[model samples]
Target: MRKTVRVAAIQAEPKWLRLSEGVEQVVELIGAAAASGARLVAFPETFLPGYPWWRWVDSNQWNVEYSTRCRENSMTRDGLEMRRITGAARDHGVHVVLGFGERQDRRIYMAQAVIDENGEIVSVRRKAGLNPIERKVFASGTPNLPAVRHGVIGRVGALSGQENQRPLLTRALRADEEQIHIAAWPGNPEGEAAGPDSAATVSRMYALEANAYVVAPCAVVGAAAWDRRGPQTGRGSGQARIYAAGGAEVVTPLAAGAEGILYADLEIGSAASDRREVELAARPRMRRGQQQAARTATPRRLGADRWAVPLMLGSGPGGLAAC
Candidate 1:
């Protein structure tokens, strides 16, 4: 039987620094997408309280007030905001992959939550690495979280912001049989002009590497958000896009500064046929004697702490605890 799924990439601005308002906006968007026949909807990175654009626009000390308010507005895994989002997903009968700032105690991480159609929280993944400016506000995450989960359409996974640029991490998700990958990115007014580090380039590369449908949900920084940052700051041009299993463009890139949902119907089962052409995971393995020899060799310390080892090793689905 042929399997097809309609997916949506949400490119909208959050109600800057207002958690309640942001959640309401997202809920309305989810309902709209569901009404339009979207089975899965992916939101932009840190759509809850919005991305830390101030971190880039000003110095750390200058952005302290914005940073503090952002943390105060950040949502916990099972917090009220999350409950509302999941509730919307359930009411609309649509799976949601939402990116938000996840707060634990006093620390916050760039995180994404995968919600099934029935309102169950299937998986929660944190960004394994943060960009330089992002490091000022978010903490690093471990690699042992369940990056992919079985959903109504197929296996879905997500990577936040710059994490889409991590080859090894994307490879691991591919090995876990991810059929659809969500590449959540913050707004970049430069768009494709931002060169190799641009979100557009990285997202397209991930689709080509994983041989899976890639849904790029990007945030838009509007005038209000710029006003909050400081005087005379500019807005971001949205760069939302969707790619098929064979790395073909499924939808034209959302225009810069546009705020709406981009939808596309994907052949979810076609990834199997694509994989057969170039199976990276099934190609070959090291000789048994060489593997044993390598195992016996002294392990090189990855970082100054024990947790760093696992972070560098990048474990598979079995290593993660049930969410």
Candidate 2:
């Protein structure tokens, strides 16, 4: 990885259900970030066609026109929209980490596509965990899937929403030696359960624990979105920010709900200490892994969820529950 690298974390109002316009805005943002000399740019969760604001605003109305529009706007992994995004990355000579709703067959997933500086998609990871409402709307991503990718700049990985909250998921990325981690969120509205303060805390903690640079991009609901007629007040932690290994903010993050890009010139050397202060910090996890492995050694197959369950529940320390 380069000793000094510049990246752009984008926080902007999504075009909101307008896939074509969203792509245009993305291309424009790429050009703007490239002109500013950022080698990598990361966008918020489901940036294309915008996040499903109705999921929180009025989920009861999901079977309406908005839901259909959302599905219609979702881009396929290899669709024309993705091709255009790749082209933009190549044209600008910059890398892009995009979070968008991915449509496959008839299902949608919260997916992140990591495009390298050469415009090649190095990795496409879906949201690792989905809540009850999300489960109803989006398909769940495979658990324990590889998170990091070998990018032109460095080892880059991304997680959307609650994925950052999963200790095991974050631990897996750390083991992968992720150098750059993108934490994507659909802007934290103040009235929501997971508020802005908590979002910032998790992101900062991830940077510190993973010993990696974090590019957190969040999306805001502007006049163009479904929440426009609702209580779309400016109370949310909707800003792009970057953090170093020591949980230090690179730039004083953009103001909440602000539409802009946060750029950080990362000097990796500053954070690359011997890590001797906590020698067993990374290795202590081995024992816990051994215990879990022992429990799942029998590996009883669970249904569509594809979880491995151990039938020998009360049979010893090597047992796992199916439910």
Candidate 3:
């Protein structure tokens, strides 16, 4: 018998208040996905009670009380609201992987959890690393990727946001030989204006490289927070998408310009076939060898002025003079 599954991407914002409020939204999404005949539903990064944009670009005028309130409102494994989310999944007989503003020992981590069909929290993955700006606010996760094999299908893991840019982390996840890959993204109102689209593109590339199915659940900025910007000042909403092995589209884009759900059916085993046909390992072999060679290469001496000439001549956005 061929193995197949249906997945849904929840491309909407968190409730932006307390855990109960967020859970209500999550339940609604999960119910919708299940009603649509989806077995697995993926949500965007920090879709639980909203993302922590205040730390990075929310500006120097951030309301400390509000940030603290949001953090306090975050969910934990032992929290009641988490149980609600898990219970909802169980009741609906769906697997859910969702992003949450996770609080541990007073530190916030951009985190996600994988709940099984039985409504059990199977695995949790924290964002292993943060970008330069994100460092100001969120905590870095431990260096590990967790995947679980349930029945005939394989459940593997990864993260979203800036972590998508990290080759090392994704490469490690790929090394684990996951069949289904998840990449969470935040929606940009400007239509892929921010790097979310690029991140999704990168996830597809990773799926192609790793010979795994990629399910990207992107988040949309809420109507009230639509115009909000980080310190860098960018627009946002979230979106959800799924990519098959070899960068194939499993479903059409669900929520393109606004809040909605996107879903697709996945044919398993396809990734494995692609894996053998392309000899996926070979793609990384040359790069790994180059790194090994670089470590053994003799050093070359150059003056500080040598670097200056290239910058002076380089043609790019921030050119020599722009620098």
Candidate 4:
């Protein structure tokens, strides 16, 4: 079916480690996207309470104080801040993909929450693995949490920061048939680089690989964030961008260090067209073992006992009875 959905990528800085203020800012952004007819809006990585850029800027011992503050300000799934975010989504009638520092027990994880238009929590996915500096403050996520969720805007999936560069992670999301994929990043002060490893390059490549709309919402490390952290550490320019199903650039890249919303009208019909050209999902070469296992597990015309015995004894012709 052909569907057109308006999506927004918010390229803005948080209120510099303040949870309540950050939530308020996000609420206003959500309202703005909704007002602009965006059915789905996505924010940058660890938008709530802000990304811990200080980890890279300050020394490990020096950043302890800042890290402590971040942990204190991190949000919980059912916390009041989350309720407010969901309330905003419900009130605006827009599905929201929000990235934040999620507090579970005593540990924090880089996570994103998918909120439905009805203001209900749909799925919360944690970053399957942490990047180098991130390991200092965040825990590794489970493999099962990387799948996409069905939303009003079709299958929505999200990955945080460096996870965008993980081919296997993107492949897993592709397997889930994501129609809209969110690549949430902490602004790359480095701006656009020549290599394929740059966030922008990887994001565009992911769009082409998945044949799905990729919405990259990046966070700007503005003066507020810098003021809290002391000084800028790396070259992180907030490069929020959107790409269509055919890997076509939809919205111009939001300027680095700028705070704004990048909007794109995604024509999902292009996905069908792109798939016809290269149907990665349907190609027989992909997931061969799993496919063979499924075919072998199919019930045969033989009596139930006969097939059951073969399957139980691991003596099937496919030699997958052990599976």
Task: Assess candidate 3 and give its TM-score to the true structure.
Answer: 0.76
- Give the worst 10-residue stretch by lDDT in candidate 4: 304-313
What value of lDDT does candidate 3 attain over all alpha carbons?
0.68
User: Model 4: per-residue lDDT, tens digit, 147-204?
Assistant: 7887657888888877787665676777677889999887754455657777788888
Best by TM-score: 1
Range of the 10 consecutive residues with the lowest summed lDDT in candidate 1: 305-314
Please identify which of the two predictions, 2 or 4, would achieve the higher lDDT against the true structure: 4
lDDT of each: 0.79, 0.77, 0.68, 0.79
Cα lDDT of model 1 by residue, 1-323, tens digit: 45879999998878988999999999999999999999999999989889877776656566887889989999999988899999999999999999899999989988888899999998887776677888888887765434678766988888887778765567668768788999988786443465787887788888887888899999887667755445443444657989886677998877777788999999877665657666656654555554445455443444432121122112332232211
Cα deviation at 170, candidate 4, in Å, is 1.6
**Candidate 4: clashing pairs of residues:** 188-236, 188-237, 189-235, 189-236, 189-237, 190-235, 190-236
lDDT of 2 by residue, 208-299 (tens): 89888999988875555654555555545466778988799988987776788999988754343445345545433335555667555664
Ranking by TM-score: 1, 4, 2, 3
CA lDDT, candidate 1, residue 255: 74
Model 2 bad stretches (over 4 Å)? 58-63, 191-197, 227-229, 235-237, 269-273, 276-323
Candidate 3 lDDT tens digits, 20-113: 8788989989999999998888888888877654554445556465567767887787688888899999999988888887888887777889
Clash count, one per candidate: 2, 1, 13, 7
* Candidate 3 residue-wise lDDT at 59: 51
TM-scores of the models, in the order given? 0.85, 0.82, 0.76, 0.84
lDDT of 4 at 296: 61
